[model samples]
Target: MRIHHDWKGLSPEARGATVAMGNFDGVHLGHRSVIDAARAAADAPLGVITFEPHPREFFQPDAPAFRLMNAESRANRLGRLGVDHLYELPFDAVLAGLAPEDFAREVLVDGLGIRHVTVGADFCFGRKRSGNAQTLTQLGRELGFGVTVAPLIGDGRNEYSSTAIREALADGRTRDAERMLGHWHRLDGEVVHGDKRGRDLGYPTANMAVGGLHLPRFGIYAVLIDVLTGPERGGYTGVANLGVRPMFGENRPNFETHVFDFKADLYGEHVSVALVEFLRPEMKFDSIDALIAQMDQDSAKARAILEAR
Candidate 1:
């Protein structure tokens, strides 16, 4: 998929796309429904209009990290959903200052020349959030474009939303989060070199930093791993520890996965690890032997859970 970073200029082909517009943080089921509406709206290119750094992040820099997925992960998911163009417009003071009608006139009409736009029913836009779905529709009619406000989706009980997914993840309800997400809750990052403690313990790991994200429960989980880059790009089932290494005196959380039956060196490779089940909460072992024994148990449980899939 083609990713455009700005809306200022465009070749004819990149403009006039029937696009889904929003933050698209996780590209969860609700986000997908809006995208589907856009795809089904017209025969133009399938596009996603989103902002970099997310508006919330920009406006509230001191707030705790609450994003479900990072930009790279979000892009990969959107590409997999068959997006032809991703207009990842920069979010900044100038963009934020645009009035509702000016945003519709400048960004949507003149800047992008979008043929149609599909947004969720609760979508709001412009400076100080002065616009709503109804505002966009009226603007679309006056500005010569089509607009679709997709109704919110629910799973009989709870609405499919990022907030609900975050709540489920925070409680270690991986299955519940997956139900709302329509996929496993995943963390994607490049494998970086670590302390090699897992290696010395006979359970080698690929470690990834988990800063600037809404963390799940600190625990061990049965995970499905996808090696997204380099020569060993493929799928693997593994047991992952998604927490700070309390035994090692580390306070920053990291994702450390031991790919079962795999012997590839994965440093610097991008991998996506999907949390399938929460096996246990984080705990420190008094001795290396005890940790190894618990790791063995975790591996066995993970294998059984994944194999059953």
Candidate 2:
């Protein structure tokens, strides 16, 4: 799919599309319903309009990391869903200041030339979120386009939403998160140099920094690693530690994965690690020997869990 960073000077073919609009963080089942609504609304090309840096990140700069997927991951997933075009609008001071009607007129009508637009029933837009699905419908009627407000999708209990997915990940419930997301929760980053403590302990690892990615519970987990852009280029089962190495006196959080029965130089390679199951909470051990013994047990348990899958 073609990703457009700005709406200005879009080609004729890029405009006049049926758009699904929202944050679309995880691209979960609920978000798919909105996209499906857009596809059903028009014969025009299917497109998605999402914010860059997320509006929540812009509004609450000091908030904890809560993104389920980064921009690159989200775009790739949307492409896999058959999106022909993706508009990643900047969520800067100017766009955030737009009033309700001005946003609808400038962005939806004149800028995108949208033939139809779809959004979740609870979607809100404009400065201070003063607009709703009803406002968009009214604007579409006046602007000569169509609007669809997708109803909330749920199992008559909890609705499918990014918030619910985040909660599950935060609690180390990868299966629950996957059930809502329709895929395993993954962390994507470039492998970087580390302290080599794992190597000294006889378990070498490929290390990656979790800078802005939403951290799952700090624990040992069974993971499946995919080498996205290197010679390895395949999935590998592994055990990973997703936390600060309290035993080593480290403070910053990172991912350290030991690919089972495999050794490869992964430095500078982009890899995705999918959390399969949480093994145990990260803990501090008194002696190196004790830590190594526990790691052995963790590795064995992870191997059993992954092999059984």
* C-alpha local distance difference test of each model: 0.93, 0.91
Query: What's the alpha carbon RMSD for model 2?
Result: 1.9
Model 1 alpha-carbon miss at residue 209, Å: 1.6
Q: What is the C-alpha RMSD of each candidate to the true structure, in Å?
A: 1.0, 1.9
- Top candidate by lDDT: 1
Sliding window of 10 residues with minimal summed lDDT for model 2: 207-216
Candidate 1 per-residue C-alpha lDDT over 1-309 given as tens digits, one digit per residue, 9 for 90 to 100: 999999887889889899999998778899999999999999899999999989999999999999999888898889889999999999999999999999999999898999999999999999999999999999999999999999999888877889988899999999999888888888898999999989999999999988889999999999999999999999999999989888778898889999999998999999999999999999999988898999999999999999998
Q: Write the per-residue lDDT of candidate 2 for residues 111-206, one digit (tens) a residue.
A: 999999999999999999999999999988988889999998975799998999988999999999988988888887788999888899999999
Each candidate's number of clashing pairs is 0, 0
Return the number of clashes found in candidate 2.
0
